[model samples]
Target: MNIDFTLEKYKTLCETISNSSYTTFTFEQYFNQENPPKNCILLRHDVDRNISNAHKMAMIEQRLNLVSTYYCRTTERVFKPEYFQEIAAMGHEIGYHYETLDKAKGDVEEAIKIFGQELNAFREFINIKTVCMHGNPFSPWLNSNIWNKYDFRDFGIIGEPYLSLDYKDVIYLTDTGRTWADKNIRVKDVIKDKDHQKNNLLIGNISTTDDIINLIKEEQYPRICLLAHPDRWHGHLIDWTGELILQNLKNIGKAGIIWYRKNKN
Candidate 1:
């Protein structure tokens, strides 16, 4: 396991911000700065954990004088009233991480019908104004198909960022493929820049956590979108490592299935 430059880069970025311009009072000004600071850390949490890694991550960010958004899933392994309230109290943004397609299992109508129920339920705990789709990595479908049928804003969601904008305007980064550049994974759904302005939409593959840290240091502050699975990042290294292993195994299985089908034909 060579050094994960992605994580190291992120750490460096955080440290640079802390030393050069970190302040309890200035935090507000920092984000609003017109020139932009070169890097904005969009720490996103896909709340899929059995334990409370989201809570711990929030605590860590708080210690660093940073705040992030946490998107909670409201299904099988989902949103609890107590957990929702706790995250809200931390003064962080709470949004929806939905998978109605998975819940509906390819039935578009069924997904929409259930989405209404889930949306109503989520409102009981928090006023969720924004949403992001839970990328069902194993599914052939990209984002939950239900999102394609209707406008989330009508359901009181301000935006589902991924579907709402072109990635070129703001760089799209995520912990997808267990590392950024999972070559086998081609995200066909998310819009990419066709103008060849790769720098503007720097969606490069990040193989290590250090990639994130490094970006925080070098780039000019551009609003970034990051996807993290709380279910994947357990506080302990052992648990985190195990989750990655399982994810890799699932990917392997998917590849094997593809290979078998190709040979059988």
Candidate 2:
């Protein structure tokens, strides 16, 4: 099989979706639509680390006339105002990929406060209508937990995928752990919808970008939210190879952590 996580494959995947019967929409567009199209794709990118990679993906999608939502973390390195503005200018939605709880060290009040600050900061670049949690695997705290004490809706946010979207309606597929089938390394990216699991929907059935394209061609699901991390898809040989090596090391560490937690419980 050819290399799957390359920019060529990524562009092919986008082209497949673009050529399909399904219409692609940004998360904000999908959420605001009174009557969404029957077969649709909500293309979302979680900009966890590399802003440049996210920008590249955004440009590709824009050239294809496809819009996607990009959730950016407010870390010093990842939060680039110019890049965010560029993505928004390309007609992509910009959202906050918040990890305030972990940053707050599990203080709910502090987390909520920090979240507001970060959200406001991001707004200076683009109008952020949605927010997504950044699951810090090493932290004991889940960033989504901040909502348990305070609602994001209060902050003018319309949606948070993990909290807002019904998995029963939209099939959630994420490239966590570098492969769609590997659930062990995923910390908070999994969906908890029982119906989705019982039906054996798209979870374990997909492994590569090609698998996703085939499924779309078959019209396997009514709607899908394809979550991709830009850092994983690189065109340059050195950068791509480096990411592969780094992810492998990270995966081993994540596996160890998962095993320790399972055994402890």
Candidate 3:
């Protein structure tokens, strides 16, 4: 049996989608396509802390003849121009995962300044057409708020999935807090657009990786943007066990933060 959240299970997830009627697209491909495929699943992988794992996932998709967008952070551990280049070489989309608002300590001007610099630094490696927000659960500032003062299109960014994608038409499912269905544990990785947020939550209480796979099998959602972190999945048994234990601790802390944020508001 493929362990949940392991690279093995991740491959199975990809196979399930491939075997189904659903067609998957990288975020950039989906946006640029004038006529998109039906029952599409936008494969969005957030490279939060691990590049090696992301590379493995990329290879799996490549072998399966699939493409997905990888939103990589500019953090010390995750940022590697060579890695980005290689991943993009596999016909995957390399996206900038920005958290400038928190990095600038909530100063919009400073945030935009940092954003330009970091984005350019990333572009030096790959042609970044799309971007995604790196929602730091510990940060008080919402990273996507940087768009309020400035427009992303001006910088040649075609889309910032959080603010740009119409959540109404696409079902957003993320493995935040190491699980799919826990609303209480997920803080910033959520859709703020009131118009679609209600409808998106209709995938009620999907708490496991299996639940998400099952949901896809049911064919209930026509379109889904599945956000998964590459760091959480491992191919080795030892690594998978380590991640399971480490992520459980993270889930507890995140749940506490969610509770505090609610009460503070």
Summarize candidate 2's per-residue lDDT along 1-265 as a digit string, tens digits.
4888888899999888888888888878877888666688999899988999999999999999999999999878789999999999999999999999998999999988898898889887679999999987778888898888798889999899888876777777778878876458876676778976654453446777888778778887888889999989999889989998988888888888888988996
Q: Which tens-of-lDDT digit does each residue in 1-265 have in candidate 3?
A: 6467888888888888877888888888888877655699999999999999999999999988888999999998889999999999999999999998998999999999999999999988789989999988888899998888799998999888888677878888888867777467777887867757777667787777888879888998888889889988888888888888888888788889878777996
RMSD to native for every prediction?
A: 5.0, 1.5, 1.7
lDDT scores for all predictions? 0.60, 0.85, 0.86
- Which residue ranges in model 2 land beyond 4 Å of their true spot? 201-204
**Residue by residue across 106-166, what tens digits does model 1's lDDT show?**
7788877877888788898787776777766557655555666777768866556556543
Per-candidate TM-scores read: 0.76, 0.95, 0.94
User: How well does candidate 1 match the true structure in TM-score terms?
Assistant: 0.76
- Give the TM-score comparing model 3 with the true structure, all chains together: 0.94
Ranking 2 against 3 by lDDT, winner = 3
Sorting all predicted structures by TM-score, with the top scorer first, yields 2, 3, 1
Runs off by more than 4 Å, candidate 1: 1-39, 142-144, 186-197, 200-205, 254-265
